[model samples]
Target chain A: MRKQKRGKRTAQEKANARKNITKAIWRHRELYLFMLPAIIVLLIFSYGPMYGLVMAFQDVKIGVPILQNKFVGLRHFNRFFSSMWFGVTVRNTVLISLLMHIVCWPVPLFLALLLHNCVNTKLKKTAQNFSYLPHLLSVVIVVNIVRLLCDGQSGLINILLREFGKDSISFFGDPKWVYPMFVLSGIWQNAGYDAIIYLGALSAVSEELEDAARIDGAGKLKCIWHIQIPCILPTIVILLILNMGQMFVIGADKMLLLQTDLNIARSEIIDTYVYKTGIGGSQYGFASAVGIFQNIINLGLVVLTNRIAKRLTDVSLF
Target chain B: MKRISGERAVNMVIDVLLVLVAIVSIYPIWYVLIASVSSPMEIAAGRVLFWPKGLNLAAYRKLFEMPQIWMGYKNSILYTSGAVLLDLAVMVPCGFAMAQRTLPGRKFLNTMFVITMYFSGGMIPKFLIVNAMGMLNSPLAFIIPGCVNVYNLILLRNYFESSIPESLLDAARVDGASFTRFFAMIALPLATPIIAIIALFSITTHWNAYLGAQLYLYDPKLFTLQQVINNILSRTSSMLREDISIEELTRITLETNLQKYAVVIVACIPLVIAYPFVQRYFVKGVMVGAVKG
Candidate 1:
């Protein structure tokens, strides 16, 4: 009688487990249907195309299937490494990126702090809207505006200088001014939009700490320095890490727009160089090789930064 | 009392400085608007400053006469609207689905989506895939590859999870409503602000997209505004100098510059008009997403 009862209990437990599995599947069926479209789209557009990266290692020819392309292991890579222009492109890319990062990253933080400190809501919103207007202007428009302002003969900038008894300067043509112009225009176009992130961070800071500081006889500046800055430090650090990770991926469109025969030496970063070679020279393999090189470097930077961030602050992009 | 008054004075000075900065920031836009309306001759001579000497719409008239400009406008509208709709169709459902924590394989799907935010199959490969799909010169090519933005999807997903209460979803489920009905009736209404934000972003991105159009479309008729403008600007010195007479050259230069500004104004105006309606939603959507993430 005891053995028969035990056997019946075991069968009941198996039945219950099967019911649970079925219920779980049924509960999640809607989610699976919803995710289907995005999954298929990403698989095709993103993951499926990853196979084409192998062409970077091949001698890719036009009109040939990527699979049929000659397998030339690391030949394009060697060519890229040996090219005379590689040093110039790498140096230009890193220097401009570093300069822009240094100058452009912190200005937004300062702007956010200033905006946060403003007592009047109307004034704050008006300032924000005005600042964000430039961000709405397309790169094409921004570049055209830059050209008009910096035109040699009839440019407003030269006209202003000439009125002050100064000679016309070829702002776009000069290599010395190229980096500065790129950095400055970048700051102009992006600072306001970037400040929104910091402003978000600033708003999250607790007000009780500021009040307590005031009660302790801390001045406004001291209170802000001690209370607010520390509160937002993690955000600043995370942004810094992310910024560093993208330090090699310079803006090719802006560089291409700004490139002239005269400024080619300074403005020809890796992106522009790859663009010139890929489209102009029709050296697809070589261009792909350079692109792959850039990706590897960027990947390394991101990993390194993530590790460092995690080690120091226990926060990481992952 | 004296120190307090001194602080107030300093604050007033800072306010004036900020106002000055704002003017400087907006000056280029003002300069272009004024210049576009000014007579090309006066603009070329550098005599017009701050405002148009004579308000004329000749450049605009000339631009309207160009068949290419109208074609560009049409292409841009088709591309932006189609892409935005596709983005929404794919992104919204996926975001809602991902928001369901009880979903099987949720962790795996989330990882897959997030992986894309960090890496991509570089541009050439993407171009090749689009070409292989026979999407070249087709409008589908422009919209399909960009159907989903992972970052936007994540934001939308997070918004759904936080804003749409679990109790509401559970109640809908208990009412014997299908998943589609539940999302359609309950969740989507709550997600309007985020939807608007993503829609605005999609429209702007697609409208300004020149690279994809340049790579895919060979037909001049299919060119978007940015692509046409780029061609005109890049080839202007050579094309005009070769074919046109010296007398007409000056006229062409002046005309082209004015037209360029006018094109800038025209291309951006629609998005600018749409912005105010979505601005309130954008601020809240961003704050929620950024703070939570």
Candidate 2:
């Protein structure tokens, strides 16, 4: 009798909770109507493709209905793991990603700090604008400029090299020059633009704290270290976490533009590999498997880094 | 006295470094411009350094003669304008709705959007989906898919939440103004600066994008400016292959080299002219978006 009475009360409570949810939803129907278009778009474009990830497991053949393909149960992944291309592409991806982080990471922050320190407002504004100009150029134009500058026979860099009694380096032809060229060109293109985010953060740092530090005999460097750096540290950590999420997904567009028969060995990362096999060769299943593998690693890296960031700095994307 | 002098010295070092930064950043764009107007022969001989050895508009003339360039320019303008309009239409209402504290499932919607930023089904799936939709080889493929960028959505949502005062909405509700009226009149008007920022962002993205046009578009008639420029670049670069004789390579270089620089300058002219006007707002936009609203 006691158990039956308790069950009746709990059932009544569950019904009341459900009714409350429906009531709340009904009250916000207008908001739901406002969001309907975006919801429809995302469902068709973003979420629909996510559902298509099943093609990674299927033996997707050309001209066949994607859903009708037979499920291969990880066969493509097995082949990718045992393949020689796997090692080469994975190694190049990691090395290039690390090189990018090491060489290209701190530049914008340094540029921001430099801009922040500038006493002349006009000079700072002009310099900032000039720095941002390269970022406006398309990848095609930037790559073309790179090719023009590094053209072995008639390029500017080689011209200067020959004038100084040095050998002209074929930047595109040599495999070893691939990483440096990629990293350096990236820094050149994005440093000034990327600095804007940090500049925004720097501007938000409290002037009162800096004034206090200065009055207490703290030097400019000391004030920056104590006040400004600490204020912007959260932004730095957040951007770093975001960077980790994107580590595996390098700019395949730029890489494709930079790639040649000579430097393919060092330049082909997973994204480019997927592009070549999936789009170029029409091996959809295998390429999809490779892409899925890359995304999984990307997700894992982001989650792990987020956890670490949350523990250490309390600044996490989540 | 020593401390004051030391601070001056540091400021001097920073100014010099900043000047170097500006020069490095601007020099390549400058180089491309001067190279475009310089004589091809002088450039080939490496005589064209700081100044043009022979001033010429021949490259620009050659670029204008290409039918593909004209078509690309037309298509890019059409697509960019269409994309900006569509993006603003979808993102503004969605962001405004998401900004409301009274909205049901707000947290769930926010998470759904942000999750897309971190994880995606990869490129193959996206291509397959677009193919299935029969949007391939069409301009819709470029303008529609990937329009609702999650980061930008969040940025706009954050902007709305922070900038729009709760009292205004309360007053409107008390006066019995409909949600639609409040959004159309109050929210949209207040969001003009951010709307411009989003429009600028969409413009650049659409203008610069070629990979999608490469994948989904096959007809040269459908190509964007960047795609056409890429076509020209790859075609010429392939001629530099070792199989080609030196005379032929040099001849090809002389013809195409200046044209390449000319194409870059032409493509960038629109952006360079508009950048200064928009530069001031974007910094504020980034700041508004940077804050955890």
Candidate 3:
């Protein structure tokens, strides 16, 4: 009798909650109207594509409505698993992303640390302003500049190589050189702009703490190690979690520009592969399957990283 | 005395490294500028390094003669302006609404927007949707589909939530002013800095857009500036799958290298001119965004 009475009361409470929500909506009708446009736009643009992921299971005909198309259970995914392109795309994507994380991850932090130590305000501002310029340039322009600099025949690097005793390297043509060029040029382009977040965190470090360390006869480097780093560790943790989530979301646009017949083996990431086969080649179902594969892994990484970050450091994206 | 000298040495080292970093950052853009004016023969011969030899405006003259380049500029400018306005219109009011404590389903709406930042249906499905919507090969492809950037939306939301005081809202309520009036007359004015940052971000994003234009646009007349530049660069190179004779390829490549630099400079001119003026505000904007709500 007691349990039944409690359940009846909770059900009544749930009904009241629903009633309150409706009342609140009516009260804030103007605000709801304000949010309507964005909600509608997102539904059409963002969620529409999400809903279209069902095409991964369908043998989508060009003119047929998506639902009317024959549904093939996991056939595209199976075909993708058996294909030669699958290994190539996945390996290239994972390796390039991993390489970037390993090589390019600490560069901005290092840059921020160096800049934080600098006392001259004018020099600091000039360095920062110039550094941010590359981030503003389009990927197309940046890749064009990279090609000019690394051009096998007339590129400045090759020119310098020949002037010395070394043989000229085919930076674009050789698959071996692709990863370094990609990772290093990426650092050059983004390190300054990326450093801005760390710089912001560093600026918030308490001057009293630094002064206290200095009075203890700690050197500047020691102060940085003991005082500044500890203070900004939370920011670093949050940014790292965010970066991990983007591990599979490598810039496919850059890869497309960098790709050539000669270097496609190294540069054909999942995104470029989708563009090439799906849009250009019109293999819609297969490409959608491949794209879904990437999305699941990216989303999975984000969740896993957030969990780990929260457990270990008590800092998470959520 | 020893400790003081050590400190001086460290400071000197830091300054020197910073100066070097600045130089390295500026060098590529500088190289492109000089090469654009330098004689093609000098560039090919690797004689043009720091200075332009036999400098001339031949490349610019050739570029200006092309009607497609002019059309690209017009199309891009039109698209970017439309995009800025659309983004502000869609995002600002929505952000303000999201920040309101009394809004129904605020948690659900926030979650829906944030989920997009991490996951999506990827490129192929998005293309199919856009095609189905009849936006392919249309200028609306540039302006509409991507106008609602989730990051900017959250930035605006957080800015409003943190910066606008609860007392202000209560006072407005006491005055019997409606939410719409308070938003327009008070909240909108206070949110100008963030709104400007969003506009600046929208401008740069639309202007630099390459892949979307490449994917959706097929007509030469509708090509963006980046697409035009891409066409010029890829026409004579190994980047694309187009076939041509080796001698013809070399000839075209040699002719366009100087023009390539010119194309890059022209493409970046608007951003280069505007970035300095807006740099401080955007820097502050990023810092604000770093502090999560």
- Best-fitting candidate, scored by TM-score: 3
lDDT per model, in order? 0.79, 0.85, 0.86
List clashing residue pairs in candidate 2. Answer: none
Compared with the true structure, what per-residue lDDT tens digits does model 3 show for residues B156-247? 99899999998899899899999999999999999998998899888888989889888899999899988988887766655644687777
Better of 1 and 2 by lDDT: 2
DockQ, each predicted model: 0.52, 0.65, 0.68
List ranges where model 1 is wrong by over 4 Å.
A1-23, A62-65, A119-122, A211-219, B40-47, B241-252
Top candidate when judged by lDDT against the true structure: 3
- Once fitted onto the true fold, the runs of candidate 3 whose alpha carbons sit more than 4 angstroms away are A1-19, B237-253
**TM-score per model (chain B):** 0.90, 0.93, 0.92
Candidate 1: residue pairs that collide: none
lDDT of 1 by residue, B1-293 (tens): 76567556656655665666577667877887888798877776567877887788977787778788778888888888889998999999999999987776778889998877666656667766787788988888888987889988988888898888888888888888888898998889988878988987888788877666766788898888888776655545455448778888777776777776676666667667866776666566557656654
Candidate 2 residues B1-293, lDDT tens each? Answer: 99999899889998999999988998878888888999887876678777877999999998888999889899999999998999999999899999998886899999998888888887888898888889999999998997898888988888889899989998998999878899999999999988888888888888898688788899888999899988886675563568888888777777787787888888888888888887776666666666762
Return the lDDT, model 1, position B222.
86
Against the true structure, what is each candidate's TM-score? 0.91, 0.94, 0.94
lDDT of 2 by residue, A1-318 (tens): 244555567777778767988998987788789888888888888887785578889988757877789999989999999999999899999999987875579999999999998998988988898987788788888888888788777678887788788999999899998888888888998898889999988988999989988999988888778888899987888888778767776857888999999999998989899999999988888898999899889899989988887898777789
Give the candidates in order of TM-score, highest first. 3, 2, 1
Of the pair 1 and 3, which is ahead by lDDT? 3
